[model samples]
Target: MARSDDAIAGSAERTRSVRLALASLSLSMLLPSLSTSIANVALPTLAQEFSASFQQVQWIVLAYLLAITTVIVSVGRLGDLIGRRRLLLAGLLLFTGASTLCGLAPTLWLLIGARAIQGLGAAIMMALTMAFVGETVPKEKTGSAMGLLGTMSAVGTALGPSLGGLFIAGPGWPAIFFVNLPVGLLTFVLAYRYLPADRKGAKTDRARFDNVGTLLLALTLAAYSLSMTLGRGSFGGLNVALLLAAVFGVGLFAFAEAKAASPLMQLAMFRNPALSAGFAMSTLVTTVVMATLVVGPFYLSGALALDAARVGLVMSVGPVVAALTGVPAGRMVDRFGAHGMTVAGLLAAAIGSAILPMVPAQLGIPGYVGPLALITAGYALFQAANNTSVMADIVPERRGLVSGMLNLSRNLGLITGASVMGAVFAFGSGASDITSAKPDAVVSGMQLTFAVAAALIVVALAIALVSRAVSRGVASTEPGAGA
Candidate 1:
């Protein structure tokens, strides 16, 4: 009876630690996404304060994103080599300190520089949070953890614009960043107290960090991200040149990785059909989601004749739905299994996108919102399922690397969607400039863009199907075979 009592007490203690670890992880997921959306809303105000052009002010946002995109994979690998717990605590500290710098900077350039540093910190947080799940949470509950992270991420993204607007209206732009201090400190403490210490004598402990490969991949990702980001609505000669450079960088990276003593990302991982398919589908789906972001505002304001407030309100539905659905979607992933949930999520998204262009203009906000909500819910479902599928069975040593790749894929998709999807909307609208386009042109562009989004989802579905088939074949061929 005494032993039984001790066992129950131990279980209760572990549960408490797990909760603390998850809280830290959730905050880690939230900060970067919140930072992204919140800063975007403050760009106009920042331009006024700094006396900078749209291009100059845009860098405040771009610097953070670019920093994250470039270093996420490297930091993930670093966490694997060194230790996720220590690195994550360092990240939280860096993020909090950088946020203070962002609030205190007097000049625009200083702010941009600070944002870049903040982005690096955010990169560590984003890369390692998911990686921590396997260590912190039980195997049966991985889906729940993934869902919780997804929910926090979506909440941060959804909450940002409104929160930033309030800060800007009251305490001013600095508070947008200053808000991170309390949250960051709490997250850091929880993590320090609850997270597992780095394991010693592990196989990865002896592996050297691949400096050369890291540099090559950083340059490659930087070039690609710039190509997709710079010039925004207009793809110019610089964009083309940057894109070409990125292509070359990819080749160089591949060569460097092949020759490295310890590659940052194993070249052999791509051979796994399911893993490859997960990356591809994640990229494709995020691109579609970005289409909604890039295109939805224009349609709401122009085609639906909504005011700025109304447009924002309507736009919030997507992320709000995503946040609300995250936990349930995760539960579904646990109940239905990641593979099936992934398929179901994709199908639902495809159907939602397919139905969107057909939504009557007369139905107004409801027409637009209903379909948008469905798409976002599907996205929430897919993210939880896909992440679980990838991370659930991964070896402990490789979790950080794999998590980083997942995040990298997502960031790449958003960047591509912002650029490519915007171009598609403009072209489909037959407008020289989207912001000033006529209502009918805006409507046409929206339809065409969503049509393209549906097509992309279909492609993702096809890949998922093929991955499933391949997995079955591989399993059937293993020792003892189908028997």
Candidate 2:
């Protein structure tokens, strides 16, 4: 008789030795999400204080996204090769120091630089934490544990705007980053005390990082982000540089990935249709969800005549629902597999997005609830199922690399969504404040953004369906198909 995975995980989690290790994993997971959100509310304040253009103010956010996007895959592969614990600790310390710098920044440029450093730390922590969970927990428990981790990030994201607003109202912009200090310190202390050392059987693979490949990838993303940031701004040279960087970057990285003995990422992972679709779907879903998160607040406050606090309250609905729905989605993944759940979620989200622009001003608060709730539910289900399917499809040894790539897709999606939505809002309202616009124009812009978001979700659904077809093809050809 075989021993059950749950029994093994239970034994492990019960051990005095593993308790602290679990705590470390929890903190590593919590801090990045917290840091990401902690500054959102402060953006407006930062813009005022630094006398920045709106595009410059956006760099304060985009810098973090770009930095994290560039490094996650490399760091994840490293964690898989070396050890997740050591890398996680290093990331924690770096992140804490960077947080201090962010709080003290005297100029927008300095702050953006500090935020980029913070993102590097975040990537390290995020990649290793997922790898750590995958390596430490039993197979039966992995989905649940990942779901919990996702919820932690979601909570942090939800809290960020409101908490930042509180700090800005009370002590000004510095307080937003300052709040992270105590939380980070506590997390570090717990991590050092509780996390376990890597098991002896794990291989310490000796592949050196492909620095040239890394640089190309970095340049490519930098250019992409630059183009997004400079939208309709006076920066033609920057745009040209970005275009060249992307073409050269992809071409060089592809050549290197194929030749390297221990590639930073195995591009072959995409050969699995389930994994491929999951990655693509991850990108699209994140782009739509994050774009909504970015734009919804403006829609509430700028266009609808609500204040900052009211916008925060209204915007909170989606993440709140997301947090509630995640665990249930995880259970469904275990029972039904990733494809059906993901497709259903995407469909619902598309419906929700389509409804958002149509929400009449005359309908009042109750009318707002329906579309928002549907969007939230769809987001929760899609995120949970997509993550599970991607992890399940990958080999255990390479989980870190694969997980990092998936996360990169999501973060890059965030960058695209923020940029695109910002451009859309800028074009439509022309009123710097969203709520002050004519009802028709506001509705038009909101409708256009929502419609684009819906289209992206539809794309995700199509990918999920295609992946299902591929999986069925593989299964049908197996030895037992005729039996």
Candidate 3:
């Protein structure tokens, strides 16, 4: 009887340990996404210090994004080949080191390089964390665990600007990088202590890294990002070179994926209509979402005459609602299925986006806040529904690859969103050409931008609606279902 009691106690201890590791891993996965947007407010400070142009400062953000975007799929494939834990730990360590470098960098070019390294670390963390969760959790509880991870990511994103504002206000910009120091240390220690090792039972076979494929993918993304950067400029020789590189790289990557035994991107998974459509919709949704992240804060502060802190507070509302609303949405998805929830989410988001342009310039806080809440709620529901559909469509073996691909698609969409919206605003406002513009013009441009974003979301809604027909009708028609 005593031996049996000891065994039970050991089992309980293991469970507790697993839970702790899961929580830490969740936080680790979340911080990078949070950090991406939170630091935007500090760009001006970095620019002034380095005597850099706005275009150069843009690279600070773009470099990190480009690095993550280009390398994530390959890193995910590598994680599967080796152990996820090792790659994750290595990623964390590199991230910590890169953060210190970013804080200490003296020049914009150096900072850009550091950010690129930082992106590499972020890619490792992003790729391995979900795979680790899939390996750790029980089959029945996988949905719940993923829901929690998504919630963490949402909350982190919501908190980023607010927290970043505080850091900037308190001790200037370096503090933002320093903030990650303690959190990274704690997570590293906790993960090491509690998480299981991955050397055993991992795929160990004859596998060779596809060097040609990796180069092609990297060149493709880099060229595409460069083209966007130079879009505001004249179409000269450099622009033509970048455009050609993008085209050639894309062709090469496609050819490689088709021929390689283990392609970095598992294009085969798109065979599942539900997963494919879900990912496609997610990409479009983020195109809108990414625009909002960049444009919303700018409008609230630049046009609405709010302070940085207030902008952070206001911008945070949508993601906060999303983090909170995710659980119930997940349950609803499980109970009903994907079709209804996704369509409803898209429609709701579209409505919310439409409301943004109608916000009265004369109206007070409550007027704007209400529409913000609607947008946030809609976005939350959309994310929950989309995540459920994509993850559920695939089995456990491919969760890492799927998560990586989903993120890559979302990141690319975000880049596209920011670029396209910026272009529209630049052209429509007539403010982009001017070195310094009046507040009124800026506001007018923002209003136009918001209207266009709304239209884009409505287009997303139409696409999602078509998805319902394609995916065997809406799933929310049953009683108490989501749609």
Say which candidate scores most in TM-score: 1
Question: 1-483, model 1: which lDDT tens digit per residue?
Answer: 999999999999999999998998999999999999999999999999999999999999999999999999999988888888888899999999999999999999999999999999999999999999999988888888999999999999999999999999999999999999999999999999999998884334535898888998899899999999888779999999999999999999999889888888889999888889999999999999999999999999989999999999989999899999999998888888999999999998999999999987888998998889889989999999999998877888888889999999999999999999999999999999888989889989999999999999999999999999998999899999957
Which lDDT tens digits does candidate 3 get at residues 295-374? 67656766677887687677777788778877666666556665677777777777877777777767745666777677
List ranges where model 3 is wrong by over 4 Å. Answer: 1-11, 169-172, 199-206, 230-244, 301-303, 307-309, 393-397, 427-451, 462-483
- Model 3, TM vs. native: 0.85
Clashes of 1: 0
- Model 3 alpha-carbon miss at residue 39, Å: 3.0
- What is the clash count for each candidate, in the order shown? 0, 8, 0
TM-score of each: 0.98, 0.87, 0.85
N/CA/C clash count, model 2: 8
How far out, in Å, is residue 227 in model 1?
A: 0.7
Native-structure RMSD, model 1: 1.2
Top of the candidates by lDDT: 1
Over 4 Å off, model 2: 1-23, 47-57, 106-108, 170-172, 193-196, 201-207, 232-237, 421-437, 478-483
Error of 3 at 234 (Å): 8.2
Q: What is candidate 1's local distance difference test score?
A: 0.93
Per-residue alpha-carbon lDDT of model 2 for 16-37, expressed as tens digits?
5455656667667777877777
